[model samples]
Target: MSKVLTVDPSLCTGCHRCEMWCSLTKYGEINPSRSNIYVLRREPAVDVPVICVQCGLCINACPTGALKRDGATDAVVVDADVCSGCGTCVKICPYGVLRLDEDTGVAAKCDLCGGSPACASHCPQGAIKYEDINKAAARRRELWAMACAVRIRG
Candidate 1:
């Protein structure tokens, strides 16, 4: 089964540990700019953890065929050597999670660390989780329904 990185925004504390783990694991440095995951804080103290959902939309958009889906992890990965640095994958990515690495000049995004994601594993708040896609989808729907019920009661 394919897994995805699921986010529970309510659990996020905006500590940016996920960013640190991702960068450190990938680049051997604690660089937030190089991290695949990003945390954006809203005005009302809401911190949103954003990452590639492994949607694979960019895989088809890549003109050079640099983007391919990992069958084992269901991750859309960019091949730096084959990538033309065309930025098509970045633009096509709806979540804006893809970027061109400053040093490599190639498209970069989450590869799920081959199977176990460092960001998900190191998240202190459990805000980010690596889970089966079906389970994640069901959980999202449940959360949305609960939110809607609360709003309706309000």
Candidate 2:
């Protein structure tokens, strides 16, 4: 079962707590540079968490083939031995999700905390969720419709 970490930008407070947790868990330090997950703030009022969609942009962009996923764990693992740290994947990520570990020089992303992400659990609001990828959007229809009804009523 493939699970994804989904985010509702509207619920994000731009606190970057997710960024702290992610960096602390993966890099053993509270360094955003090493964090795979980051909170991106854009312009007037847009705060969105940038994380791996597992859409394979980084995978496809990797020239050294160091970026690979563990099938058994469903976690994307980076092999530093083969990685050149050229930063192509980091450059290509549209979401600004992938980032270079300043010390290690390799890119990293949310590996779902080896199947149970701590960030999602630590999130104060219900903005983040670890859910089935196949049925990821199944609930969106209902949610959007409900929002639409509210708009009509108000």
Q: Top TM-score: which candidate number?
A: 1
By TM-score, how accurate is candidate 2? 0.80
Best by lDDT: 1
Stretches > 4 Å off in candidate 1: 150-154
Q: For residue 100, give model 2's deviation from the true position in Å.
A: 1.9
**Candidate 2 residue lDDT tens string, 40-154:** 8997777877667766678878999988887865776778798888999889877777777778777766678888887787778767778887666775565678779989999
C-alpha local distance difference test of each model: 0.91, 0.77
Structure candidate 1, residue pairs in collision: none
Q: Write the per-residue lDDT of candidate 1 for residues 1-154, one digit (tens) a residue.
A: 8788899988999999999999999999999999999999998998999988888899889999999988888788888889998899999989999999998899999999999999899888889999988999998998799889989999
Q: After superposition, how far is residue 62 of candidate 1 from its true place, in Å?
A: 0.7
